[model samples]
Target: MSRFRRTWLQHSLRAALALGATFSLGLGNAQAASTTKILVGFPAGGGSDAIARILAERMQIELGSNVVVDNKPGAGGQIAAQALKAAAPDGQTLFLSHDHSITILPMVTRNPGYDSAKDFVPVAGIATFVNAFAVSGGTTAKTFQAYVAQVKQQGGGKGVVGIPAPGSVPQFLVQVIARKNGLDLVAVPYRGSAPMMSDMLGNQIPAGVASIPDFIENHKAGKVRVVAVMGTQRQASMPEVPTLAELGLSGFEEVPFYGVFAPAGTPKATLDKLALAIQKTIAQPDVRDKLTTMGLSVGFMSSDELAARERSYAKVWAKIIQESGYQPN
Candidate 1:
């Protein structure tokens, strides 16, 4: 070939490579710009998992990016919490967890390995709801009042009430109910609701406490009965079930809440974007209706409001922990 023709071919090759490089760089930037993930501190079928999935699906549409729900369950949410802080502070990764792992776990553990105040920034609250204490299908206690009387008769020896974990709201509720009624109810601890529900189904433990919604369908199907609802008022989903107060137990209110958080130092703009996405996803009428059907009310709060609520709840839980005589393990 002629030298001039060969030179022209080489120039053409160089131009093509330059264009490819530019396209590759642009694609990289676009991928980095578009992808976001929400991490849940529990396995699938758990409340956080459900919330993460719902938010991920909706937020993906709202934010125009692929939103993924990653479950990193272990150490009672410490694993996910630590992983969240280690992730890039670019709003690409978020943590969706409930009150126990975020507030209760740290307060009860000597070194939980993550500081909520320093390592994370609140993005938005997802939902808040109560737990219902119920007995297995085969249990003889049919009513909350009857359950109380049965516990009194057994003097807390005849039955064991299972709780997800120590220092959790459900655990405290168990302690409070047992103590207030002068019943010697023993708490059987489980890793989480999934296993606890399994035990209840198997009748390994006759009575158990779980997220209100987790047991709602079962209650509706007549597979189990709620003996007590742990809040001041009857839950909107289960109006027939009475609160602890109405059952003649005063001041037995325990409400569990969940929220979203990003790693600390994440830009306010990024967090705001995420918050807007969350609000948008949660504000839909269908979303609210579905969550309510699941026995969870729509609970969305601003960053500041969520932070303040966390602080106040921490103090209250800390006091309860001290009163319950719980020490870090």
Candidate 2:
């Protein structure tokens, strides 16, 4: 009674197991084909976009999904931030942005169209970068002090400077420097750093304020010279350059950050998973070196730590903006 029945039962069980494995394989492939997009607030050739692409390439492999970068450039990244707010809480869409969009935009704009606190949650912190003040090739000034002197000598201590965008932190920095120096300096805003760089290269603008990454390549190319930087200490990429504090311009020790964010209401588990993948990618030697070479201080911060750092950064900028008496746009 037993031999025939036992043999038949074993064969049936093996066939069922094989079918289940085949089904699971097909499901995994389908999931892998689903695309995950990282939204960048700046144009493609900018620092934020570069970082996003690098991280997306690595994250695609780590997350075992299709990861891609989507640029939404305008209004100092207001457009991209608004897109993130409108996105669903699913893990598929994320915003890869720096402090200007996440921390400072709200403070400067009356209505930036998106609220960081209410509409987004920090996923991870990628790196921190510092702002720089640079002059064009046509300018005779070799140093920021000399530039100011030239402005005083040639233009009655009045000059026009380029900024990455309106309501940007660099714009405020221009005011801070002008106020401290007792000169009339006005910041002319552009759409992004790339365009600002273009004007500087063509000598259409005498000087501009932007991130170190934005100007470092040109600084090396000799088209522009980074005369001063905003940080407590000098950068490794440009050790010869002077810090704002060294130039007797203090109180700007706060460094700007680049991080990833998911729309609010996204599950904590999903956020945590993405954060871990980012931490893994940043930990890679090649990724770290690439970002470091771009004048960034590459480091990973936890989601909660990033959120806290963002708030602290906002507070610092808030005071500076208020003291400058700059009206919100």
TM-score of each: 0.89, 0.90
**Candidate 1 lDDT score at position 10:** 100
RMSD of each: 2.8, 6.0
Q: Residue by residue across 1-329, what tens digits does model 2's lDDT show?
A: 59999999999999999999999999898875577889988888887888888999999889988899999999999999999999989889999989999988998889899889999999999899999999999999999899989999999989999999888889989998998888899899988898888899999999999999898888998999999999999999999999999999988899999999999999999998899899999999999998998899998999988999998999989998898887888
Q: Return the clash pairs for model 1, or none.
A: 156-184
Against the reference, the lDDT scores of all candidates come to 0.82, 0.92
Error of 1 at 34 (Å): 2.8
Q: Give the TM-score of candidate 1.
A: 0.89
Count backbone overlaps in model 2. 0
How many pairs collide in each candidate, listed in order?
A: 1, 0
Candidate 2 colliding pairs = none
CA shift of 76, model 2, Å: 0.3
